[model samples]
Target: MGGRFQSLREPVFRQWFFSSVLSASGTMTQGVAVSVLVYRLTDSGIAVGWMTTCTFVPLFLFGSYAGALVDRIGPRRVLLVTQTLLATLSGLLAVLTATGAEQMWMLYAIAAISGTVSAADASARQVYVIDLVGADRVSNAVALNEIVVNGSRILGPAIGGAALGLWGVWACCALNAASFLPPLIVVLRHKTKTVTHPHTQKIGGLRYVWRNPTIRVCVLLAAASGMLFSLNVPLTPFTTAIFHLDGTGFGLMMATFGIGSLPGVLLAAAGPSRPSGLRVAVLAVATGVAILATAYAPTVTLAFVGVAVTGCASIWFISLANTLVQLESDPGMRGRVMAVWGMALPGFSVVTGPFIGWVGGVTDARLGFGVAGIAMILAAATGWRGLARPTARTPVTSGASRA
Candidate 1:
């Protein structure tokens, strides 16, 4: 077990990891609350979808630039600024919701503001892990990070739901607002000698990603999967109409998805550090199958089971993709590469969020969800040819070699 978690040997990473888990749990709780709150306010899947769209629009727009910025100045400096801004945003959100000043537009505005900050924060966080743990433990560190993400899904949603039901949206938002403190303190107190790469300009990252076949495929795969992952946007409708549940039910439903990823995280943590195309292709198919199962499930219990399966498969797929991209890219170019990775992951949702919402609005949530499942399968099949080819491990340092 100790060997499995060798990354923890680094004191900086250890502190950052635990603090991040607390902050992430709060973020998850707030996320559940925000979804439920939007649904209650507007009572439309499309409205909830629009909220998601608002959040990712900034990520889509400025993600690449943010990555170059991180690479130039280093991730630690960027994280310090972004984290503080995010905390302030959360606080502002709590105030607005608490004072009954939250309109749909207000929520949208807040989400957009946070998303803007996250454009830089997300890449900073991704690359900062490498800084803390070094390249050797990158795979384990990334898996553990995924665990923080999915594990928070377990606690955050449950707490968010109960708080929303018992207290209100403000309380849930407040909890999330408070959650940022630990990570902020950790970032403030921690110090590292981050090397700045002057040559890592904005477009350089894009060119690097475009030239690298493995990374190119990874970006494409991440973007394709984004459509299916946007299922979170319509989860409110799924809880209310499909499952006939309230806010608490919605929280549990989200929690089920988070809980399901535990097995996948364990598998990835124990698995190889170097990523394989075949492994990624298989996980993508499994995720699609799991999503389809959840979509067609007749009973809520069965739906939860299917959701759990999807969560497990999806986490494994994403963890592998993240590791592959991070490992394959040059250290100096990592931020830019991960920035594009972020764009593919959550940033691409700017398009899919609205589309999924529209689909659920016009048709049924199940059908819309089924469409995502179909998209995932098609994407995997399309990318299979490129992904199936074995990528030889070589010390790829610069733009000199396109291999």
Candidate 2:
């Protein structure tokens, strides 16, 4: 155990890992706080859904552009700017909530601005990991990133909720805003310089992805996963209404999913390099099945178990796909390619959020979950053959070649 722990203590991994943890925790806390705040103020499922939509819509509209920017400018500078912007926005939100001047529209506007910054930031960070850890350990690094994200999911909501209970929502937002400092400081302090990709032109990355069959299929699979998994957002209303639980119960349920995700990350970390498309397809099907099972769960305990299963499947699918993208993409185009992947995930969420909310408002939240499951299964079935086929691999160019 000591040896294993020591291996991750290498300087490059340590910096990236610590930065990832801080960013993930802050982001998770912000998500929960925003969702809960919107729900409390509006008491409408659609309104809460709108909050989520506003937070992601920018990715769809500006993802390609953001990718181009990351490639041209380098990841380090982009991340620094992103961290500063996020901290400022989060602080503004904290102050607004504290003063009781927080309104629904204000929340929406802030979420939109934050989401725009996040889109560029996410693309940069995804590509930056390659610089830190080298290509050989990309899968392990991706898995570790997942672990950090899940750890935050486990702790962030619980902590945010506690802060909300003790000192009001403002406290949670304040802590989240403050949490950005560690990563920003780390990025600013890094002595090792980042190298920029040669291609600064806007359309190059998009053209490359359009021409690559494997990358295209991978992006589609990710988008489908995004759409299907959106059921979780609206499902919160059902759990609260059906199980007669409160915000604390919602936090605990999310924590349960986080618990199940840890093993999936470890599994990915241990696996050898292989084309991940087929693996992702299989995991997508499994996730859909798990969601279907979750819809039928009659008790909170059973529902939590179902969510745990879904979480494991979801993590495996997403981690494998991410690893494949990072491994197979042209280094010059990686930032943009990753931006496309990030866009698909959040972009689908923006469109699906209101629809899922509508479904829950009209009938039952279980119906939303069931429908999403079916959609995911259909998507997986349609793409199975394409995803399974072996394709020519792209060689890395630019600084990534050094790895």
Candidate 3:
């Protein structure tokens, strides 16, 4: 298990990891603030869905191109610039709220901009981590990465909820704006020379992803999970409407998911660096079952428990897939491969977010859960062979060449 903590021993990773913790907390807080703000302002579930779509649709359209751009430019340069742009967007949001001039259209624009820039960071960071931590520790590093993310997931919402309850929506945006500073500064001061794997064009990224079965399957499965999770847009509204929960209750509910995810991440970090594809499939299936159960949970208490299990399965499945993809791909193509994932993974949100919100509006929120759960289960089943198939033990490439 000592291996699980190996990446932390590196000074650079330690710096980035700590910064991500603060950043994640602020981002989660902003997430809650944004959801509540939209719901309160419009009082329409569809509007909430639109907000979610605006936030992620850009990812679907720009993900592959952003990844290719990262490869062409460099993760360091890309992250520094994206962080600055996001911080500017968040600051503008704060101003809009402070001036009482915030509009639904303005929110949508910012969400789209934020999502577009964030997509680049999401794709590039995976590649960046490999350079920072080296290949042998990649699995452990990814798992540890989840721990920071999950840890923030655990605490960020509750804090966001508290901030929303006390300070109003602008506070969350302000915090997010401030949170970008550290990462931006860290990237600016970082000293290591990054190894670049330049891709000539964006079209090549799509073709490479299509030609590789393992990468292809991982992206598809990730998209399935991403769709189910995208229900996050409506989760706040559903809890308030059905469970009669206040802000604190909603925060607690979100935190409970972190409770489940924390252990799952640790288990992944502590286990074998290379977990089996069969294992990933099993976890995905379990996540599907958990989501289905959560949908029909008779009470809030049951729903919390179900969400916890769902959270656990979700993290393990996604993290394992990330490890496998990072391990399997040639480093030269990895940025593009992850970019394809960035594109496909959130592609579901463009449809699913609004669709689930509509379902939540027309019938019940649980119906949305049913739809997502069934979709995931079916996806896992159909892809089981591809996910479970054995593959050659490819050496982890360091961009130069694979052993």
Candidate 4:
């Protein structure tokens, strides 16, 4: 197998990869449509913030336990259950929307339900990457997955925007509900055996993360950088208010961000397999600056340019951090560790998402962007030392790494 795209050479992984792209496309489309729907219904940034909070609350609450669960029973089982629940929830949302049920409470309810399943699904999916491609090609596999995520960002929003213009929000929701089938079918067809970890010591995933310096830094910085990364909340108002654009323009704005991420992902895939702390820090700072620039961008073109740069930097930072944590973790504990990663990044969004939204609501989306930018810069400045620290060879570290 070739080095850069070696993960794709695995037949199972290849199939899983394509299936995930199809699934993620619908997921991404629904996400954009939902945001637009919320804005259209309430016209409030605070409402958008609350929707984000609802979506992430489950991850914030149960992410670590979800990871431990994945490690205990294996990712395959967890994915099977979660995906089924997600498909049901998407279908439910579609039904409600079709019936003219655009109430805030209803949207929040569905988001909470979907978020709950995602708490496990996200962790399982990360572990599933290792399961499909093995540990050796984990970095390459992760990079490819990032492409799927960001690539879907491009495709989903464009399709969603068009769908919204033509068939309405219900169509996007229905599309998402249907989109779950391909991945479910793929999971059903893929025959990876379950391997449970029954004898491992009872260490909490958070505690383990605290003990590992490299992972600890990666997670903490991820938490700190999350506020800046919650672009969707502010982007809602930024697109409509600043750009004065409709659904298509909003979709294009998001698609441009995804577009920028591809080159960065490809570049990372071509580089050394190992992740670098310096690169993470640099990208964090760059992400902040780009976001700040976008906040102040006077024209629509400049705002698009700014977000594209922010997307490239932000995704690069996240991908590197993910690779670092995965490579540093023990095979037995990888799921739990990644769960912590999930918490630090997405779970933390519960707080940042609302706050950013409120800022956009009260002041301006530009000011919200400024706040995120400053916070990111400060996080990188303070966390750089810890992030740059080399892994020490303590007994705990040695034992855990070799586990």
* Local accuracy of candidate 1 as per-residue lDDT tens digits, 1-403: 7766778888778888998998999988998889988999999978886777788889888888889889899888999899888888888888988898889888999999998889999999988887777666778888899878766867787799899998888888888888888888877777666666877574577789888877788788788778666656668777788879998888788778778888777777777878798898888888888888888899998998998988889888888888888888877788889999988887887777668778888999887777677777888887787778877564433211111
Angstrom error of the Cα, residue 385, model 1: value is 3.3
What's the CA RMSD of model 3 in angstroms? Answer: 3.6
Q: What are the TM-scores, per candidate, against the unseen true structure?
A: 0.85, 0.86, 0.86, 0.84
List candidate 2 stretches off by more than 4 Å: 1-9, 35-46, 99-105, 191-193, 198-207, 237-252, 296-303, 359-365, 397-403
- Candidate 3 residues lying further than 4 Å off, grouped into runs, are 39-43, 161-168, 231-253, 293-304, 357-367, 392-403
| lDDT by candidate, in order shown | 0.82, 0.76, 0.79, 0.80
Q: After superposition, how far is residue 204 of candidate 4 from its true place, in Å?
A: 1.2
Candidate 4's displacement at residue 138, Å, is: 1.6
Tens-place lDDT digits, model 2, residues 255-317: 777787777777777766544677777887888898789877898889999988877887877
lDDT of 4 by residue, 130-226 (tens): 7676656666788888888876867887789899999888899999988888888878877565456855649888999988877887787788677
For model 2 the local lDDT of residue 337 reads 91
Predict model 3's lDDT versus the native: 0.79
Candidate 4 collision pairs: none
What is the alpha-carbon lDDT of model 2 when measured against the actual structure? Answer: 0.76
By lDDT, who's the top model here?
1
Give the runs in model 4 whose Cα sits over 4 Å from its true position: 1-3, 32-49, 96-106, 161-171, 193-195, 235-253, 292-304, 357-367, 392-403
